[model samples]
Target: MKIMTCPFNGPRPVSEFFYWGEIRPMPDPATCSDESWADYIFNRNGAPGVKQEWWCHIASNTWFIAERNTEKDLVLRTYLFEEEL
Candidate 1:
């Protein structure tokens, strides 16, 4: 079984975590055009590469970011959201 290291809860079975979608920037709603907003909501690059994504621990309700390689489906690192700054 695969293990995912949670920033707060240490290592756990991958089954204990939920895969959230990729992390992407959102444009300012006030200044963004309708087309831009629509594209942002519906479009995805879908390229195979390293990307940041969100994951959550089921029992602890902890949310964190995982830097992963899409091609290998390997999680390179896990960190708290604030630590990304």
Candidate 2:
């Protein structure tokens, strides 16, 4: 079986992690434009490179950031939500 290494934990089954979505253009809903809101919600560009992404640790009940190598199925880095500035 394929396993993934969660930086918060150790190696584990891929099922333990849930892909929340891409992390970008997180705008303030109150002042955001219709076009910007639509783009943020409906558009997605699955580019392969270093990017910030949201992921839920289903097995651990934690929200965190993940630096994913999209083309390699590799998680370059992961940090808890609390770690954010």
Candidate 3:
């Protein structure tokens, strides 16, 4: 079983967190084009690299960011959502 370290709360079971989706460069829907909307909403490339993904701490009801190393099945970094930091 893989372990996930929450940047806010420290180590926890992977199953305790839910994979929300990819962290987008731009999250606004009104400004996005049709193709961009489709890609953001439905398309995802399962490639190996540093990817920004959304993760929700189900038990805590908190949301956070996870920088994932796909090839290694490792989380490079994790952090709480800070609008400015």
RMSD after CA superposition, every candidate? 1.0, 1.9, 2.3
Model 1 lDDT tens row, 1-85: 9889899999999999999889989999899999999999999979999999999999999999999999998989999999878
TM-score for candidate 3:
0.78
Q: Each model's TM-score?
A: 0.92, 0.78, 0.78
Worst 10 residues of 2 by lDDT: 1-10
Error (Å) of candidate 2 at residue 78 is 1.2
lDDT for model 2, on a 0 to 1 scale?
0.78
lDDT of 3 by residue, 1-85 (tens): 8888777778999999999877766657888788888877777777788888889888887799898988888898888889325
**Which candidate has the highest TM-score of all?**
1
lDDT of 1: 0.94
* lDDT of all predictions: 0.94, 0.78, 0.83
Off by over 4 Å in 1: none
Q: For candidate 2, write residues 18-55 as lDDT tens digits.
A: 88877886789899999999988888886677777888
